[model samples]
Target: MTRLTATAENQSLCTLSRDGSACSTAKYHEGAIAALAQARRALTAAEPGADPDDPIRAVRARWVGQAGAGTTGAAWRAYLEGGRDGLDILLAPAGTSTGPAAGTPPSATGPTAAGERAPGPASRVLVGSAAAGRLGGGRWPRRRVTATAVLTPALFAVLVAAGGGFPAAAPWTVLVALVAVAAAATLATYLPGPGKGRRPALGCSPCAAMAAMTVLAAAWFLQAAPHQPSMAAAALAAVGFGLLQRLTQTDASCAS
Candidate 1:
C-alpha cells in the first residue's frame, strides 16, 4: 500500500507543469488520479461508512477538478513559491466538514456520526507535497558534508600510503588526525541542531561542489582499503547520506 501511494505521488509530480497545457507531463495526471481514486475506494470499503470525509477523496477531487476547470494549481504553486505555509493552504480544504479554509486547524471532534475517531489534518497526504523543492533547490545535510570532508582526505592519504608513494609515517597519521579534528570542529560550530546556530537554507550548488571534491575520496578508499571493511562501509554510508538531504523546510522556518 505504501509503495502504491509513492507511485501515485510520483506520477502526479511528473505530470505537473507551470502551465496546464496538454504536455507530456499533463498526460500522466489521469493515471495518477485514477490510482488515488482506487486507493480511496479501497479505504472507503474497509471503513464501510465509518466516515464520509476521507482525505484521499478530497485530494483526488481537488486535483482533478482544478485541472479540468483550467485553474492553475494555486495551492501547490504557492508551495513552490512559498513552502510549508503554502502546503498548509493547499491541504486545508481536504476532508474538512466546513468548506476549505487556509491554515484552519482541523476540528477536535472525538468521533464521527459512525462512532469512529475522525482523521485529522495531520493525517491528510497531498501528492507532490512531501518532496517539494528537492529536485534542484533543496539544501544538503550538514552531517554528510562533514563526513565527506573528513573521510575523503583520510582516504586519499591511506591510498597514497598503500601505493608506496611515501612510507606510512607518524606525520601522515598526525595529518589524518588533524583532518578529523577539523571536521569535528566544523560540525559542532556551523551545523544546525537542537540548540545550535540558525542559518538560512542554502541551495544545492554548494552541495554539488562538495560532492565533486569528495567523489575522488570515495574512489580512493574503495581502491586502497578493500581489506578494511570499516573504511569501505564509511564510504558507502557517505554516499547514502549525500543522497538523503531532501528537506521540506529549513529549521529556521520550522522554528518560527
Candidate 2:
C-alpha cells in the first residue's frame, strides 16, 4: 500500500489499483476522447490502402469505437450522480481538489452505497422550502388553486350563515359542491397547464361562478324576502362566463 502524502496543494489522498486500470478523472477522459477524435480524423484522411498494422487504425477500431459499449447503464448512472460524501471528488482527477468548490452547495444528504442519494425529508415535504420557494416546478400553483377554490365557498358560506338570506341554512350541499369542485380542480392540476390546446374537465370557471352566484342569490333572496323570478337567473352571468371559457380553453388547459 502506498502512503498518500497530503500537501497544501493536494488536500485529499487518492488511491490507484495495482494494475492502474481504474483512473476516473474528467481531464483524463476528456484527453482520451480528444486524442481519439484527432487520431480517427488523421486515420480517415490517410490513404485508402494503408498498412494493416497501422497503430492509428488499430486504436480507432479497438478502443475509441468500443469505449461506451463496455459501459453499462448502471455505470453511467453512477458516474452521473456521485454520492454526497465527496464521492465525486474522490472520482475526480488527481490535480483537482474536491474541497468547497464555488457555486456547488454542500450536500446535507449523507452518501448512499450508490452514487445517487434518495430523496430527503425536505424533498418529501409538500410545503417545504423547495416546494414553496421554487420559482417554477413547485406546489405554489396547486396551493393557490386550492386556497381560492376552498376560500371562495367558505366565504360565501360565512356570508349566508351571518345573514340567513340565501337558500335555507343547509350547508351540506354547498360544502359538498365546493369539495367536489376543489377535488376536480386538484385533478386538473395533473393535466397540462392552461391556454395550450386542451381544456381541463374540472373548470375553475364553474367553481368561481357557483361561489359567486351563491353569494348573489343569498343577497338577492334576502332583499326580495323569498320573492324573486328565479334563482336560476342569478347564475346566468356565471354560466355565460363558463360557456365563454369552454369556447376559448383548450382540452388540456388545467385552468382550475
Prediction-by-prediction clash tally: 0, 7
List residue ranges in candidate 2 displaced over 4 A.
1-141, 158-233, 236-247, 250-256
| TM-score for each predicted model, relative to the true structure | 0.28, 0.21
Q: Candidate 1 lDDT, tens digit per residue, 1-256?
A: 1221232342223334444432212222223323333334434454544433454455445444543344345333322222222223323454544321242122211111222232354443322332232322234466645654766566556544543444445554444444343333323223443332355233223442343334345446545654344554554454434333322122211110
lDDT score at residue 209, model 2, on the 0-100 scale: 40
The sequence of per-residue lDDT tens digits that candidate 2 reaches over residues 1-256 is 0101111111111222212323222212222222333343444555766642253444435433433655444322222232222223222333443342232222211122234433332222221223122212233355446654665556445434434435553443344344334333433343444322343233334442443344344445334432232432333333334333332332211121
Highest lDDT: give the candidate number. 1
Q: How well does candidate 1 match the true structure, expressed as C-alpha RMSD?
A: 17.0
The 0-to-1 C-alpha lDDT of every candidate, in the order given, reads 0.36, 0.33
